[model samples]
Target: MSLQDLHGLLSNLQRNPGIPLDLDWVDSIRVNRSAAERRAATLPARRTVKKKYQAAWLLRAIACMDLTTLGGDDTPGTVRRLCAKARRPVRQEVLAALGAEQLGVRVGAVCVYHQMVPTAVEALQGSGIPVAAVAAGFPHGLSPFAQRLDEIRSSVAAGATEIDIVITRAHVLTGDWRALYDEIAAFREACGEAHLKTILATGELGTLTNVGKASAVAMMAGADFIKTSTGKETENATLPVGLVMARQIREYLDRTGYKVGYKPAGGIRTAKQSLDWLILMKEELGNEWLLPDLFRLGASSLLTDIERQLEHHATGRYAATHHQPMP
Candidate 1:
């Protein structure tokens, strides 16, 4: 289906309300790492979208991206610039050439430090783009439990409609599924109306089996979305890890009839990689998962590359990287 057709469906999507923790289901989860790796290895070579179709797919990627800025040196000015870019991502000239000006092309959200949520919210006002905040101690998830919940509340109070929270890796490491589930459930309650995106931080979770199990517990505890990483890990958002999580999402849907979104953050920096992820979602979860509501690409540099690709499509030659700056 066309991207335009998805706008309405996104508004109508039912939020994942969560269910009682089912240890039996969580314990039953498993993964074949070699098979997952073999399948992931074959994705890029197996499918390709070129020319005009490639441009369209890239545009969809832009719409599904969480245009992010999570640096230690981030300032109010930095966040404002990021919000401006998120609002107008692709240049108008490039969009006009592709006859997609009316596609209303824009990134899915502007992700920033909690301190900058109000700045992003103010900058993106009336743009219909939500502000996403990384909370619950973020990256490490080691803050005292009460403090983590307070951080979530503070961000939500700051007008962040989406909270991207980090899960305690220790819980998963020790196979403490119950602890993991309760923690996520409490975070979901604190989130209230704001969507809760549970970052699995899969990179530090030990194995693919742990990745699958953590994904199941997070979804079972009511995460509106399951994210692959905090973008801080040494290894983040690998295709094999993404595949395991996608399979878990599919299983959750089949059993509970609730759809949870998937996001692969960090290490995804090229336009081709964006298409690879889009293909993964489409092939694994079908067309519905391709929409921004159910899928998001959490990257800051990915947009610059995508804009460059779109510009290349609009004009036969590649433009200088300066022409497509992202904050």
Candidate 2:
């Protein structure tokens, strides 16, 4: 992929409208655990990037990141601060040193809780940075079904262009594929023009095989993006889980001729880890998935580490972590 393309950032890609639920296809899904682990383990060692190319990759990672702030203590002030950070993820000196100051580098979106959607919207006004609200009871999808739909509608009405909805784990656990499909389809409908990102909470779903099946059901039900977790689970994003999800995305594209996005949230905290994910996208799904529209790293602190790395690349030494603080 050309490094020049990263400057354009977010794309006006077509949304995944979804296809009819294919129960047969869902049941046919299977993941080889050992193979996935082996592949993921070997991925990092296989490719190494340095100098200007590595800097370019890091910038691309920032562009695809969903700078997020989802916490009980989160206030509007905190939300506004987070929006400011999203608008200019890298420091001016760092971007200028890399000759990227004019690139207009920015995060893919700013994610927050339902109540903070408007606050983020107002802060990010006219910046073209989409505001993503986490709904459906957030980390837990146990709220009343109607209430979940209501939450989605309210956020969209408040100006959230994207809605990150969690799926009912019980539906996947009980092998109720139809229930999962119906749940996501309803969330998609409520989203309307707003994009729908379905969180599988893969860590709680039991096995990698279940991860594959859940991913298929989400895409079949019309999830514009299938996220790995809500970032609250004991086990958040992992390479094995991501590999399984990427494979599902590839299969979905081959079968239905539609493209579904993939996001690996939580536990992804370093610049090196970000490069690993970008390599995974380029190797498995090709270059298109590297863009913000198809890939997102749901992280809050990851940006700090990325900025520090960029600083290190620009100069020859590391700066104190406080220099790259987040709100």
Candidate 3:
């Protein structure tokens, strides 16, 4: 086999493990971009509206998404409860229902800890909903690179399509841009065929300027997505950080012509807040940015509120009796 064939084979073996390598792994990873785009073409605006701004985004909240919180105060039982209360599985059927028009489930993907990749992988096997896993000693990047690398490999072994990694704050804070770049580049390599989302822990990054600079560096070092925070810091996912990161993404896209996705997670538990992020996307990136391809809200509690809003929209009044509030 030629060099390209070898590279492709190894990449696939690295991405899709368990089965012995026989066919071209690269071929398995190859996607028909045109076909995917054609199939995934956003539905045309079936319902027209005259309003300049709308809270229609509340219809798409991924409620009770149990992001693995390995940090203090977050437990496995908590995750189980959240998933139980969600009344949904990580199966592709569930993701299909979410993206389908019937119930119009709007969750982008189920976010989980590195250990739960198997659950999501099994649940979403052959499903479009990507299994997203947190890495780089998520909640904090204090762990060594070896640990982070192991996390990435394990998640990939468990079939995570996307890896969310935390950036080394000390390096970035100390103006060690090269170190930061290298750190992210390592993750990019470990990701192989999967998408990489680098988190800046924006709340701890101190300023909007740093957030913007960090976004640029992360994107430059090959981040397919630059997430705002890990939702475990003193504060997670603030508008200022979102605004800063979005502005930088717009700027970077303008300069490089590469559209990098953005995710703002944490504290976005209300429909109003979620819509506010959508509004930010609309104002900054225009109407085309409204899709989940380029934007996502990393939220755990926003769903019930979104559902409530959807109910309110469908009915004349919001019903508090039928809905049970989540912790």
Candidate 4:
């Protein structure tokens, strides 16, 4: 389906209303590292969509991206520019040449720090793209508990409709499942109507098993989405880690009948990598999981590369990266 068609489809699906904690289900989770690694190794070699179909898949990927700017140097001007890009992610000529100009294509959302939420909101007003703010002591998530919750509230008040909270990695490392659950649940309550995405920081969670367990706990504790990383970790959003999290989401849905979204952020900067992640979602969880509501690529430069590829498809030649600058 085209991005325009998918937009209407996503509008009708209800947001994930979280369920109560189920300790047994959480504890039963286990990750077979070798098997997961082997499966991830085969993704790139397997599914390869080409030509017009490839362009279609690329458009779908664009609609599922969270165009992001999380650096300490981010300013309102930068956030506004990012929002503008979010409004029209691809060049009009490229989209028109592909016969996709009428589709009104755009990225899934604009992710930024709390300070940039208002700017993003204002820039994206009437465009229907949500402003997602990374809160609750982002990156390390080591601040005091009260302050973290307060930060979420403040971001929401500032017009952020999505709150991406960082879970205390220590909770996962120490086997403090209850603490993690309570912390995430409280963050959910603070979110009010906004969606909550719990970042597991899979790289620092020690093992794939820990990543699986943490994913289950966060879902049980009412995380609307389970994110793979904060994009600041040394190793972030690997396919192996994404597979573990995706399986956990499938397991949670089977047990509770509540579908949780999955996001793999950090280091996903290429068009091929985007297609790989899309194939993972389709094969692992089915086509329904490929929508913006259930999947988002946390990226900035990824859009630039995707645009370059689409231009190549339209013109039969690749353009220089400088010609496709991101907002």
lDDT of 4: 0.90
What digit string (tens of lDDT, one per residue) describes model 4 on residues 72-188?
Answer: 788889888889889889999999999999888998889999988888999998988888999999989999999999999999999998899999999999989999999999999
Clashes of each: 0, 0, 1, 0
TM-score of each: 0.97, 0.97, 0.73, 0.97
**Model 1 per-residue lDDT tens digits across residues 90-207:** 8888989999988888888889989999999999998888889999999899999999999999999999989999999999999999999999999999998899999999999999
Model 3 alpha-carbon drift over 4 Å, by segment? 1-55, 61-104, 321-327
The sequence of per-residue lDDT tens digits that candidate 3 reaches over residues 51-87 is 2223234443342132333434645555455444433
lDDT of 2: 0.91
Clashes of 2: 0
Error of 2 at 261 (Å): 0.5
TM-score, cand. 4? 0.97
- In order, what lDDT does every prediction score? 0.92, 0.91, 0.62, 0.90
Expressed as tens digits, the lDDT of each residue in 1-327 for candidate 2 is 433345334346767889889999988988889999999998898897999899889999999999999989999999999999988888898888888887888888999999999999999998888999999988899999999999999999999988999999999999999999999999999999899999999999999999999999999999999999999999999999999999999999999898999999999999999999999999999998988879999998999999988999999778899998899
Q: Worst 10-residue stretch by lDDT in candidate 1?
A: 2-11
Alpha-carbon deviation at 245 in model 1, angstroms: 0.5
